[model samples]
Target chain A: MTTESVRVAVAQTVPEFGAVDRNRRRTLEIVRKNADADLVVLPELATTGYVFESESELADLAEPRDGETASAWAEAAAETGTWIVGGVAERAGASYYNSALVVSPDGLEGVYRKVHPWNEEKRWFAAGSDLPVFETPFGRLGVQICNDQWFPEATITQARAGADLIAVPTNWVPNPDGDGRPGDWTAGVHQAVAHADANRVWIACADRAGTERGTAFEGQSVVVAPDGVPAAGPAPADGEHVLAVDCDLARARDKSLTPRDDALADRRPEVYDLG
Target chain B: MTTESVRVAVAQTVPEFGAVDRNRRRTLEIVRKNADADLVVLPELATTGYVFESESELADLAEPRDGETASAWAEAAAETGTWIVGGVAERAGASYYNSALVVSPDGLEGVYRKVHPWNEEKRWFAAGSDLPVFETPFGRLGVQICNDQWFPEATITQARAGADLIAVPTNWVPNPDGDGRPGDWTAGVHQAVAHADANRVWIACADRAGTERGTAFEGQSVVVAPDGVPAAGPAPADGEHVLAVDCDLARARDKSLTPRDDALADRRPEVYDLG
Candidate 1:
């Protein structure tokens, strides 16, 4: 039921606006470089850049699960014998949803739509209705997109659903209101660490670099251990990076924190009213 | 309904084991020092040092809400004309619970028992039944103990209940499994920051310093703003200090993150299923 350890890689790339074909080629290049990776992750909307000027531009760029975005990732996964999970601008019928696609060597394993869309994303895409965790050779995989990280419930739900690693494909931008201070409170890394510490889970956050149109992103991809320690890179804030980590995936399932404490088992759910 | 800005204080101290009388005296000294603070916070099991060997030891130290612990803190509050929230080892009838008490200039306001007790506290203390938010001159106040901070629902519930600040009285110990990295994931400060970021509420975490028996406590007490900024002192890891910050309590009620985003108002509760 387990692969013991997983050699994971995160490809942090900033896609050019509306350049779908060029982005797909660039993705393949990075995937090939990390040929030894068991699991590969990329930034959100990696095929098409974020920040749409209008609905027409979004409609033009968005593709379905079976489209070029999925096909390219599937080809890479099958060729390299790696599992790929990342975000895409998904088209369904007449509507589009921000989605995370899980692709294995076999093909597309599953897709989880971004449950909580960021600011203008509400205008471009419909909100997702379900949280999905896909089964893999290593363990169970839970996926989330940008802005979804802000909601603590998203991680809690996935952790409760038995996710071994929560893959985060994000296009993180600097907070306009954030007054940068030298402490745990001011950094984006805290959010991942908080959830990982509380849930006793592993988290891999792959964030894009460079600016899209007028919007700039913070690139700090990392693989966090169950102990809430960053097992790998936060990458450079402005550089393209291929972050890698060799992790014992089984640690995510072991909730025992102290000799007497089990993080999930010790929880008093009856007293908590999330509704 | 709004008090312009409230000056808050957090007293971080390490109590000597089996020295309740000296601890009480020490508590009064710190309360008198922060006479200008509108609200003050102290650490969990503030009087009785943690790391007990047996139930009999806990039984011997546990006091009633109106016992010496309350009266001493109450006397200080009355003299200072300030409100105080702190943790205590409470004995209700024959049962003991790790509790948070709200004391104002008038008298004892309310008590919130620690719902989620960490490690051996479970064996000694009865679990809490409710999460209470008390109204004060500054704003609504929510209270929690050490291990309770690990749960996001604790903060979310308080934030929804109109809590302006969550006063955390924590006897924080070093992570038994911590690798000592330079990032934010392993620290208790990050958890507060994450919840503060997500809920857009102020958090006052008063952690103790120094070692008790074989266990070491990490100090660094902080007052986090709604934007997840440490508005005050994280004190120091090895020293006993009082941390204070002047904050506009009105910001807690205003969850607006961006022009179109109100952090709490944007939560789609229907989609989130923690179970």
Candidate 2:
């Protein structure tokens, strides 16, 4: 199962609301600490945080597409010779986008905007049309942020597009209907595992920690194998945590779940209705 | 959450291979034992068993749509005032279909032919075209068999078709990559949870137990809540077990995962490339 071995790090850290400078420093410090890891992932909106008081406040704190946030991360990645993926609230021309910025030792390489905005984010951010897969130093990476993880189509599409791993930068809130059980009906963890197994792709979700504007975040940051089991930390429910796991990206290539079943090949898409 | 509360029974039992008469009797016994239950569900091909040695053997054991299997289950349901749903090897005209038979006190209410046949079954059965939703006394019921549950789109489409509960009669095989983690990777339990939570629908999978022809059946039968958590037994890895849970079918109606996020309403289907 070991092929193209890579060490991945998930930084589940808290971001101060509307504090761009502080959050940028926090993000840089977290990424620098994991310099030995081949790939480092940070939580959603790591540059500005979540839960805006107003659209104006979000705009005030948002960075430009090629802004200070990207430069800082690129510099850090270059210094560490690592590939970094993190979420940011980006100002794209006249509109704003909840984006996942990709940084490699070479430079800031790609940006993937959130396809499906969650809740009030729809009121602020423009939904992205082009979902790009990045051929990185570590592996082929697909980007998703927060609510986009809820859609199986997003993950399925990424897998078809040849992404070995889907990196989710998430600001997860506590599920109101949690039955004290962790998997389903609570958070997107099980969905991550489900999609990973079904699509034969590794899934690493870096979720935010602590309370922001009265909303508590679920910080069960996880790195799941293609086999649909956790290879790394489900972190802590609410805290700053660092988790690193050695992953063989090759295992994600074979969609064959068993001797008989090939995930995508076995799909009866012709009979399926996408409603 | 309580709108229409109904007691549903899942009988996780093994069917002797090539013994249709004995297996039919066994199914009747299980259903009669749970006579008090509002809805009773059994495993895939409960009357004929799984893993047929030959196409001729499968045809020999197959029952007509209105034959012994349906009549026995219908009689049991009528005598007990219960609605029964279970898998059967059906002889539809000259072609065979891996079907889920729905029996009420009235008689055979509906038959949902297994659309996506697993491996060898593809050689023996004709794939179904229409995936129908039944308006039952218990709730709006959607039926699927073993391998069909692997596809998220099938379940999501069922939810969209106005089914409160998706009843899956499955003969689950042990996952090739299972490290005994007991969730998504192992059984479809977490995938069931994931899809159910994403669509706000209750899912009940009644999987078989015991080994047949060197293939081990995973007997983790479960009834999951609309919130994507199990409400009943994953029975055991291998055993004869009966699980019953009183579920509020209405919670499945409110797709509101949070005050802000409505599962179906939030879907960006336009951007989804199911290809």
Pick the TM-score winner: 1
TM-score of 2: 0.94
List the TM values for chain B, per candidate: 0.96, 0.96
Q: Could you give candidate 2's per-residue lDDT for residues A1-275 as a string of tens digits?
A: 12478888989989888888998899899888888888889999988888887789887988886799899999999999888899999997779989989989888898989988887887788889877899986679998987887788898888888899888999988666767343432367878878887788999999998898898898989998997788986877878998898888988888875476688777777777775
List TM-score per model, in order: 0.97, 0.94
Model 1 residue B62 CA deviation (Å) reads 1.8
Stretches off by above 4 angstroms in model 2 are A1-3, A180-186, B1-3, B180-185
Candidate 1: where is the Cα deviation over 4 Å?
A181-187, B180-186
lDDT per residue for candidate 1 within B1-275, as digits (tens), equals: 13969988899988898788888788888889889889889888888988888888888888899988888889999999888888778989989998888899888889999998888887898889787789988888999888888888888889999998899999888786776445322368778878888898999999888898889898989888988877886678877899878888888889987787888877777877765
Candidate 1's displacement at residue A222, Å, is: 1.0
Best by DockQ: 1
Candidate 1 chain A weakest lDDT stretch, 10 residues: A179-188
Clashing pairs in 2: A185-B227
Tens digit of per-residue lDDT, candidate 1, span A235-268: 7878789888887878888888878888888677
Instruction: Estimate the Cα RMSD of every predicted model relative to the unseen true structure.
Output: 1.7, 2.4
